[model samples]
Target: MPISSDHRQYWQTNLRYLAILLTVWFLVSFGCGILFVDALNHYRIGGAKLGFWFAQQGSIYVFVLLIFIYVYLMNRLDTKHGVNE
Candidate 1:
C-alpha cells in the first residue's frame, strides 16, 4: 500500500529540517573550528582561543544544542501534523 499524503509531508518536513541542521552543524564544526580558525583565533574564549574552543568544546556544545532543538521542533511538528503521541 502507498503512504498517505500526510505521512509523505511529514517525512519531507523532517528531511528539510535535517538538511538545515546538518548544514549548520557542519559550518560550526568545520568552518569555525578549522577553515576559519585563523580568523576565529583573534577572539578569546575564557583561557583558550576562540577557534580552539570551538574545535574542542564549542562544536560539542552546539551539537548538543542542535539535538535538543531538533527534538523540540519535531515534537511541535508532530502536534501540528496531528501525529503527536
Candidate 2:
C-alpha cells in the first residue's frame, strides 16, 4: 500500500529529532560521564560528586528525561501532522 504524504513527513521529522536527541544523549553520557568524569568529580552538587553521580546514575536519568522529551516532541509533531491517535 502506498503511504500518504503526511505519514512520510511525520516519519522524516521523527527521524531528524531522534538523530539530534541521540547525539546529545551520547555526548552527555560518554563525553561528560566517562571521558571528563575526573574533572567533573571535582564539582559537587547537593553534597555528591557530580562526575561520579553522572557516571553511575546521572546519565541514565538524563536518558530517561530525553525519552520523555522525545515523546513530548513527537506528540506535538503528531498534532501538527494531524496524525495523533
Candidate 3:
C-alpha cells in the first residue's frame, strides 16, 4: 500500500531535524575541535586550551545536549502529527 501524505511528511520532518542536529553536532565536534583548533588555541579558558577542551569535553557536553534537544523536538513533532504518546 502507498504511504499516506501525512505519514510521509512526518518522516520527512524527522529526517530534516536529524540532519540539522547532526550537522550542528558535526560542526561543533569536528569543526571546532580540529578545523579551528589553532585559532581557538590562541585563547585560553581556565588555563586549558579551548580546542582541546572541545575535542575532549565540549563535544561530549554538546552531544548530551543534542540528545535532550532531539527528545524535545521529536515530542513536539509527534504532537504536531497527532502521534504523541
- Cα lDDT tens digits, model 3, 1-85, are 9999999999999999999999999999999899999998988777889998898888999999999999999999999999999
Report the poorest 10 consecutive residues by lDDT, candidate 1: 40-49
Model 1 TM-score relative to the real fold:
0.95
Candidate 3 Cα RMSD after full superposition onto the native fold (Å): 0.8
69: Cα error in model 2, Å: 0.7
Residue pairs that clash (backbone atoms under 3 angstroms), model 3: none
Of the pair 2 and 3, which is ahead by lDDT? Answer: 3
For model 2, residues 59-79, the per-residue Cα lDDT tens digits are 898999999999999999989
Question: Candidate 2: lDDT of 83?
Answer: 74
Q: What is the Cα-based lDDT of residue 37 in candidate 3? A: 98
How would you encode candidate 1's per-residue C-alpha lDDT over 9-75 as one tens digit per residue? Answer: 9999999999999999999999999999999999998989999999999999999999999999899
Q: Which ten residues in a row have the lowest lDDT in candidate 2?
A: 50-59
Look at candidate 3 and tell me the lDDT of residue 17: 94
TM-score of 3: 0.95
